[model samples]
Target: MSKLACAAEAGMLPGMFKRVVVFWALLVGAGWSAGLPLSPKEVVVVYNANQPDSKKLAEVYRDARNIPQDHLIGLELSAEQDISYDEYQKTLVAPLRKTFDDRAWWKRSKNPEGLIIPVQNEIRVVVLMRGVPLRIKPSPLPEGVKVDPKDPIGGRTESAVDSELAIFGIDGLPVQGALKNQYFQSKKSIREANLPFLMLTARIDAASESTCERMIQDAVEAEKTGLWGRAYIDIANKFPQGDNWLEAIAKKNLEIGIPTVVDRFNDTLPLNYPMTDASIYYGWYDWNVSGPFLNGKFYFKKGAVAIHLHSFSAEQLRNPSKNWSAGLLERGAAVTVGNVYEPYLHLTHWFDVLHDRLLDGNSWVEACWMAMPVTSWQGVVLGDPLYRPFLHLNGDGKMLAEDKDYLLLRSAAMRWGNDPEEFNKQLGMAAERLKSGTVSEALGLDLLAAGKDTQAAVWFRNAKEHFEKAEDKLRQDLHLIAIDRKAGRKAAAVQEIREAQARYGPMPEAKALAGWLDILEPPAPPKALPK
Candidate 1:
């Protein structure tokens, strides 16, 4: 059947199906879940056509993500950190607009002449490459134009490149200043977001090119094991709003089911605190790395995500040896977000929104973009835009110890496959411990990862047979689907999903997995539109 026909059969409009797919891709971040993997079809990579390094970086990302060649858009722009408003419009904006139109990505409406006029909503995100201008210089006031008294930045001027891209669909030059993010605090998944004026924007940026590449790789790897570390939030003696925001985020962290450590009364995470195994860390009001940082004594887990709020926190994302952003990345964080310039406390990332959104299952890029009040200002999200942190919530409750043990199987599987000498030694150990479905499932994943599909399938079937509860059975079945997909058995994966759904009948996991598969693996392509 055609893709549109499949949408119709699924009881959704074609546009709604696309939106649902986009929404699912953005929200489904974590391990062995029902949603689609982030696809190249949903991405558009923008590069400075004039810069060799920018082209090189864009190509690397595109190749890594399998982004379609047509999805790549380039513009000739100056190699400067900032540009005037006119220059922004003439160079970046105009070219971007033209590219979207040519690609049939920009929304269109029928005019009085019965012609299509560009509107909005073609793409979910625009990834600005390394060479693009990072900020826009404010235009001089013409003939005594008065600024809004309520404006925070002494007359709402200048804009960040990624932020301005959020408002790219606005008609004429946007002089009304920074656009407000409607999605803020809504905590809606991207599929549920009511975005009309702006498309989400992220950039593959850092102080250096190698750092940018590593950031992307880390995001992908982190998504594999899922976000399995700790959340450390440190707040000093607070300002009313700042304190409120910090407290709310701390509350949100607990609410979202992450193992969170909230240090509210202290100036920082106490120096003596054992701050190891951090997956997500947020601390603020420090001018530089503080006591909580522990002078490199702590070890951040692979794909760790951390952020520290300070004026120049992002001054050098490339320098791992430094005190701020780079230091966090160097110390092994998969992602870190902060401002490029001195964004006063209020203007920086809203802790509440950022935390809540991540818990709600938005990717790092989407969460950061949605939480930021002013995109054209200073806040910059640095990481893989596709990184989804909370994809493995097993029915609202945290993953049980058994479930965590299943996660450890990834390492065991690696050892089993890589160390042939140890495999024989481990075989005896597995015979004793592989009596349960959990261990069997881990073995299944290990074998699957090692390209042993037939053996993996046998282990998965064994897990299903040994399941103690309907819930356990359903969880293993869902996991089997992920394994099948990875093992190049998508057809078998669908069969497993359908069979589980039929047996389980409307369980949340079953329904979500079914819905995600329906949207992700559409029946077939409709005509020649982009995949």
Candidate 2:
């Protein structure tokens, strides 16, 4: 029987069946868009026709994702990283507009304000390939124009090329500053929200062609097994806003049953902090990629999604070792988002919102735009836009012990969510049976948050035993010592640190212990020997 018949047989209401069936048909062959409103048919791939790698990358993505043949739009463009604004309009935007009109990818209509807008936009996403220009250089202002002191962002006319492309449908927008994203914090999908002025944009780009290909493959692989492993959240604790963003993220992770490690240190995570099994990482305020990631031996888990917040985090896209985004990509992160220029903290991607959206099964691009307060400014989503990292939340109970533990804990939390006592009891029993360090650490963090430090310490200890890495155990040591320090056992905390410092030896993980030691025991100042 036809799918329409199936829908009818499934008891779809008379008025909604056609709409639902048509939507289902659009999703029938779209691989990465199962639950997302977007389909490959809605995506238009833009590439640099002048560059062999540009067009090649577009084809690679198209074949991999089974995008439609006519969706690929290659244009002659500059080989430089930064393009003039005029060139961006003439060579890129104008040509794209022409293509959309000629091909009837969308229908134009007048809004209530008589503004021309796409009433039925079939093309909702634009995928810019690697060789396309990364940023648009700010053009000179007119001779008579004067800057306003109160408008901080008005002076900045530069924007990420991808970000600029996202709003190509809009008319008469100012060149300076950013426009508020219509989809920011939106509870509905782009289609459902009828967001016609905006087109979700993403770049499948990296320092090298091989890395880009790997990124595409990794995103696909991640959706299969699920984005599994512990989350590493480095709280810069700079301001309440930034700190709260991270704190809420930690709370959400705990609620979801993902094992999370949160570093509350003001300074970015120190060098070689032994961050293992990191599938999701969010940290901030570091300019260049440093700290644990600096270790040559360290790399995140396959399909890991990491983002290190910085103003110019994506200043240059082709240098893997220079900034946070590319560096993480080269070091095995599948997806990351960043700003190409200086965007104020609040205007940047709301990391917590992105986390929630992804967990709620939104695609990467949708979640990214939903996370940002503004666009046509400087944010870029790097990786397959359709990657749904937490799609595994809809899984059967049969997975690896580590992966399965996440499922089991989430189930327990859902079943007894209203009863904290029952929730903890189920978690404790699962930790014992599964022998999962991730589950134990999750429970420990939850208990610690509830002010049950003693119980938290027990689980921390249990987690330490299950974990094989020395740094993992040392993290548990820090947890235990923190509990001791709270109980006015500073001396015991210091003693444990001293022993751990010696036991762990000169390994990079020992650096974290030494830091705690200094906090607990300040070394004596040089005696006033001269005095």
Q: Tell me the spans in candidate 1 whose CA falls farther than 4 Å from its real position.
A: 1-39, 108-120, 148-151, 191-196, 255-257, 270-274, 292-299, 315-323, 342-347, 395-531
Once fitted onto the true fold, the runs of candidate 2 whose alpha carbons sit more than 4 angstroms away are 1-36, 109-116, 143-146, 482-491, 515-531
**lDDT (10s digit) by residue, model 2, range 380-464:** 9999987877765644212453455555555555556678887787677656755667778888988987788888999999999
State which candidate has the highest lDDT.
Answer: 2
- Per-residue alpha-carbon lDDT of candidate 1 for residues 33-128, written as tens digits (9 for 90 to 100): 333344567678888888888888899888878888888887888988778878888998788878877777767666566544444565776788
Residue 127 error, candidate 2, Å: 0.8
Q: Give each model's clash number.
A: 3, 0
In model 1, which residue pairs have backbone atoms overlapping below 3 Å?
29-391, 30-391, 107-119
Report residue 396 deviation for candidate 1 (angstroms): 13
lDDT of 1 at 473: 69
The ten-residue window of minimal lDDT in model 1 covers 394-403
Task: Quantify all predictions' global Cα lDDT against the true fold.
Answer: 0.63, 0.81
Q: What's the TM-score of each model vs. the native? A: 0.63, 0.87
Which residue pairs clash within candidate 2?
none
